[model samples]
Target: MTDSDTGHSPVWARSKRRRSSGGGGGAFFGFLVFLLALFGAVVIGMSIKERSVAGGGAAIDGWIATGKASVMQAIGKAPAAADVAVEKAGDAAAATGDAVQAEAAQTADALKKQ
Candidate 1:
C-alpha cells in the first residue's frame, strides 16, 4: 500500500541507501596495514628462529652476525649470567666447606697438645 494509505512507510518500503564501508579507506592505508602485519609476523618468526636448534645455520653464517645474536639479545643474556652466578656460588660454598674442615682439624690438634 502507498504511504498515504498507511500512517508511515513500512520497514521494507524504506529507501535508506547504505553507505559503502567495504573499501579499506584507500590503497595507502590498506598497504600500510599489510606491511605492518607482515613486519610483525617476520619479527616474531625470526625472534623464535633465533633460539631454535637450526638458528643461524650455514645459510646465514656468512652474514656479519654479531655471534648469532637475536634482536632480543639482552633478554637471553639473563640466563647465561644466572648460570655464571650459580657456578660462582657453588665454588664459594665448596671453598667455605674446605676452610671449615681445616679450622676443625687445627682445633683438634690444639686440644691434643693441651
Candidate 2:
C-alpha cells in the first residue's frame, strides 16, 4: 500500500517524527497515568471514611449479636434428654455401690470363718 493510503504518513516517517517531537505524547500519557493513580487513591480513602461513618462498624457488631442469639435459640430448642440421662446415671452409681458392698460382705464372712 502507498503512504497516502496509510493516512498520508509513511509508517517509518511517522516513527521518525514521533522520535523528533521530544516525546510529547509520552509525557502526556505519563501525566494521565499520574492523574488516574491520584484519583484511585482519593476514591479508596473516601471509601474507607464512608464505611467508618456509615454503620459499617455497627454492621459487624450487629452480626455478632445476631449470631449469638441464633446459637442461644438453637440451644433452647434442643431435646429435653437431660432428666432421663441423670436418672440413668444415678441408677448406675447405685448399682456399682451395691456390687462393691456385696463383695465386702463376702470378704468379711470369710474372715470371720477363719
Q: Name the best candidate (by TM-score).
A: 2
What is the alpha-carbon RMSD of candidate 1 to the true structure? 16.7
Indicate which candidate wins on lDDT: 2
Candidate 1 lDDT score at position 58: 31
TM-score of candidate 1 to 2 decimals = 0.37
Error of 2 at 25 (Å): 67
CA-lDDT, candidates in order: 0.72, 0.79
**Each candidate: RMSD to true structure?**
16.7, 21.0
**Per-residue alpha-carbon lDDT of model 2 for 16-46, expressed as tens digits?**
9878797588788889999999866755665
Give one digit per residue, the lDDT tens place, for model 1 in 1-114: 788788887565554422244354666687999999986676566557787535634324535365556645977898999999999999999999999999999999999999
Clashes of 1: 0
Q: What's the C-alpha lDDT at position 74 in model 2?
A: 79
Cα error, candidate 1, residue 5 (Å): 78
Candidate 2: C-alpha RMSD after superposition:
21.0
Q: Candidate 2: TM-score?
A: 0.37
lDDT of 2 at 70: 100
